[model samples]
Target chain A: MEAQKVLTPSKREQQKEARRNAIINAGYQEFALQGFTATKLDDVAVRAGIGKGTIYLYFDSKETLFQEVIRKNLFPIRDEAQSYAAEFKGTATEHLTSHFRRMYQALHQDRMPELVQLVMGEGLRFPEIADFFFREIISSNQELIQGIIKKGVEDGEFRESFNAEFTQILIAPAMVSALWRLQLEKQSPLDIEAYADAHIEFILRGLKA
Target chain B: MEAQKVLTPSKREQQKEARRNAIINAGYQEFALQGFTATKLDDVAVRAGIGKGTIYLYFDSKETLFQEVIRKNLFPIRDEAQSYAAEFKGTATEHLTSHFRRMYQALHQDRMPELVQLVMGEGLRFPEIADFFFREIISSNQELIQGIIKKGVEDGEFRESFNAEFTQILIAPAMVSALWRLQLEKQSPLDIEAYADAHIEFILRGLKA
Candidate 1:
C-alpha cells in the first residue's frame, strides 16, 4: 500500500520528460547548424516553440541543455550495448563480433560522426562534462567488456595472455581510422561497422591461443 | 675550392639558426602557457625579446613556426630512439623493446604533458594541422616500428601469430593514458613520463611472445 504511491511515475515526471525531450531536439538542431559556441538558448527556444523562460525551467543554462542533448544522444549507444550484454550467450569471440558490430552501427548513424566531433571538441573546454560521459558511458561499459574477457580467460575459452587494459588502444584506432577517412581521405562513407568488425577479428586472431 | 663556399657556415646561416631557436623557444613558452588558440605571434615575439617583424624573417607565420616547434621538440626523441636502435644487436625482440622504450621516453619528456594538451585541444579547431602531425610524426613512426616487428616474425624471434597491425596499437596508449590523466582526472603537475614508461611496460608485457 505504501509502495503504490511511489511505484509509478507521477504526472509531473511525464510532463518533465516531455519538456526535456522537446528541449533536447531543439538543442541538437541548433548545435548541428551553428556549432556549439555559436548556438544560443534563444535560438533553441524559438525552434522548440517554447518561451525562453520555459527552457530555463527545464535546463539551468545552455551548457546544461547541451549536456542533456549529448546524454540523450548517447543513450541509444548505451542501450544497445547493454542489450548485447544481455542477449549474448555464445563464446566471447562470437559475443565480441556481435557486440562490436552493434557499436559500429551506433557509431555510424546519421549525424553520429558530427556528434563525435562535437563531443571531442567540447570535451576540451568542458572536461568535467566529458568526464561524466566517460565515467557513466565509456569506462563503465568498458568494464563489462573486460568482464567478458576475464570470463573467457578463466574458462580457458581464449588465451590467458591478453591485456584488457590496453585493448582500447587497438579498438580506438579503427574509430580514428573512420574519422580519418571522412576528414582526411574524404572517402564516401563506407560501412564503418564492417571495418570495425574486420579490425576486431584481426585482433582476435592475435589473441587466440 | 668552389665547394668550400657551400660547405662553410655562412654568417647568414648561423644567424638563421639563432633566430630559429629563438622562435622555437618562444613557441614552446607561448604554446605551453596559453595553448594554440589563445597564442599569438606578437606575444611570442615579446616573450622571445625580438621584434614582431624579426620573427617573420625566421618563421613564415605562426602556423609554420608552430610546426617547426613540434619538429624541434621531437628532435631529442628521434635521437634517443636512434641511439636505442643503435645499441641493440640482437633479434627482433630486442629492437622492438628498445625502440618502443625510447619513443615512450620522448613522449614523457618534461614539457610534453602540457604541450600534448595544447596539441590535442587546439588541434580540434584546425583539423588539417592535427592530421598532418598524426600522419607525418606519429603514423610514419608506427610504420618504422612495424618494419622491426616484421623482421622479427621472419627471423622466428616472435610467434608467427603476431599481428603487426594490432601491435602498433600498443605504442599509442602511453600518450592516451597521459591524455586520460590530464584531460579526465585533472591531475596536474605530475611527471607524465614516469606514467608513460609504466604504460609502455604494461603494453610490452602483453605483446611479448
Candidate 2:
C-alpha cells in the first residue's frame, strides 16, 4: 500500500469550516421547513451528514445554531447593502430603485423570505429569538432604509414629510411580496419583477418633492 | 316533584345557534394558538364547553370547522367592505382613507390578524385551507381594492398607469402592520393609528394624478 499523506493544519481548519457551514445550511432548511420550535437537531445532523454530537462542537444548542444560521446567511447581505448605500452617489430615487432591484433579485436566490416567514410565524412564541432577530436584522434594515430616505428628504429629492418612521410603509410592498411568494404563490401567482417595478414607481411618485 | 316546562322551538333553535357559535369561537382560539396541524378537536371541545361529538354535530370535520370559523369571523367584514365600496361616493383617495380607517379599527377589535398569521404560517402546508382562504377572502378582497383602483384610474383621481394589478402594493402596509402586531410587538411597539395614517398618506401621494 502507498504511504498515507499527512494533513496540514490549514487543511484541517478548512475541513472544520466546511462542517460548520454544512450544519448552518442544514439548520436553515430544517428551520424553514419545520419552524424554530419544531426543528430537530438530530434531523439537522442527518441532513448535514454528521453525527448529532458533532453539531455541539460548532453550536452549543439549537437556538445558537439558529442564530448562527441567521447571522451567516442574512447579515452578509445586509452588510453588502449597507456598504452599497454608503458608496452610492445618485438621486434618492435612483438609490431606492437600485436597492429594491437588488432586494427583488436577492429574494429569488437567497432564502430570506423563508426566514421572514419563520420569524413571523414563530417569533412571538419564542421572544428570545424574536429579540435577537429584531436587534440584528429588522432594526438594522430599518435604519438602512431610513438613512436613504432621510438623505432623499434633505436633498429635496423626496417630500419633506417623509421620514424614517415611514420606513416600514416604504418597505411594506416587498414584505407583502415575500409573504405572498411563500404562502399564496400556488393559489395566486405573483410576478415578482413586475411587482417590484410597480413598487419603485409608486414610491418614487409618492415621495416626489 | 315540580312539573317540567317544555322549551319552545325558537328557544331550542337559539340554543343550537349559540352552541355552533361557541364551537366556531373555540376553534378560532385554538387554531390561532396551536396552528392548524397541532390543534386538536378535543381541546377545542374543552374550550367550547361541549362534548367532542357536539363539534361533529355542528361541523363534519376539523377542516370543515376551520372553514366555518374563517367564514363566520372574516367573511362579514369583507362583505361589509364590498358593500361600502359599491355605494361609496367620493374621490378614490377619500374612499381609500375611509376603507383603511375601518380596517385599522377592525384590526384592534377583531381576531383577523391572528387568522392572517395562522394562514401565512400553516397555509402552505395545508393547501386545501389555503385554497379556501384565497377563494373566500383574498380573491374577494383583491377584487374590492382593484375595483376602487380601477375607478380611480378612470376618474382621473389617480395616475393613468395606476391600475388594478397594483392593488397588492396599495394595501401592503396594512398587511405589514398586521404582521408586526402579531410577531414583533413586544420587542418593538408600534403605534398602529399613526402607522395607518402614514400608509394612507403614502399611498394617496403615490397614486396622485
Who wins the DockQ comparison? Answer: 2
Q: What is candidate 2's CA lDDT for residue B92?
A: 79
lDDT of 1 by residue, B1-209 (tens): 67865898777888888877987998898886666656888898898888899987877878788777877886666555655665668777667766766665666566786666656545534666676666656556666777777777687665555456543345545555545555555523334555544454544444455
Report every candidate's CA lDDT: 0.66, 0.81
Cα-based lDDT at residue B165, candidate 2? 74
Per-residue lDDT of B151 in model 2:
77
> What is every candidate's C-alpha DockQ against the true complex, given to 2 decimals?
0.17, 0.59
* Candidate 2 lDDT tens digits, A16-77: 98999999999999998888767899999999999999999998888889888877887888
* Full-model lDDT, candidate 1: 0.66
Evaluate residue A15 in candidate 2 and report its C-alpha lDDT on the 0 to 100 scale: 95
Tell me the TM-score of each prediction against the true structure.
0.71, 0.88
